[model samples]
Target: MEKREVVVSITDNGPGISEDIQSRIFDPFFTTKPIGKGTGLGMSISYQIVTEVHNGSIQCISQPNQGTTFNIKLPQKYNRVIPQ
Candidate 1:
């Protein structure tokens, strides 16, 4: 499937996270963002949706003071029809 070709990335200009903290960024309810600004479950739930539901993987790239980027690899087509 062409969908197997991994792609997609998200970048942010905000302060980058430390390696220690980055490791846990995808943990349930984990977020570097301030309370109310984010729900803290975004990345965690995203990980599950990509890997478990879509059979894909996600990665983070960052350096202190250099901002952050999230790469998400997913299938182009889903087994279950998704509402547009």
Candidate 2:
């Protein structure tokens, strides 16, 4: 989203996820991190809030050894905090 659209993003420089595992990235409690580093629910919950709760969209893009980016799209008028 841009200009008149709502946009949200998350980026990372870690070892990019494999294509086989990409589909499960948003599943609850799914994580590539170590035990203490994460609980793995953050993404699943975030996705739920953006789509089901706020009627927005979320997506992730990644490349091995490069980086990853998460993009979220929504209607500008639906940005409750921005007051368009």
> Model 2, 1-84: lDDT tens per residue?
554667878799998877767788989999989999999999899889988987888988887897888899975774457655
Best by TM-score: 2
Residue 69 shift from truth in candidate 1, angstroms: 0.9
After TM-score superposition, the amount by which residue 11's alpha carbon in candidate 2 deviates from its true location, in angstroms, is: 3.0
Worst 10 residues of 2 by lDDT: 75-84
Q: After superposition, how far is residue 77 of candidate 1 from its true place, in Å?
A: 4.8
CA lDDT of each candidate?
0.85, 0.84
Can you write out model 1's per-residue Cα lDDT over 21-63, one digit (the tens) per residue? 8889999877777877887788899899999998889999999
After superposition, the stretches of candidate 1 with alpha carbons farther than 4 Å from their true spots are 1-3, 33-39, 76-84
lDDT of 1 at 25: 90
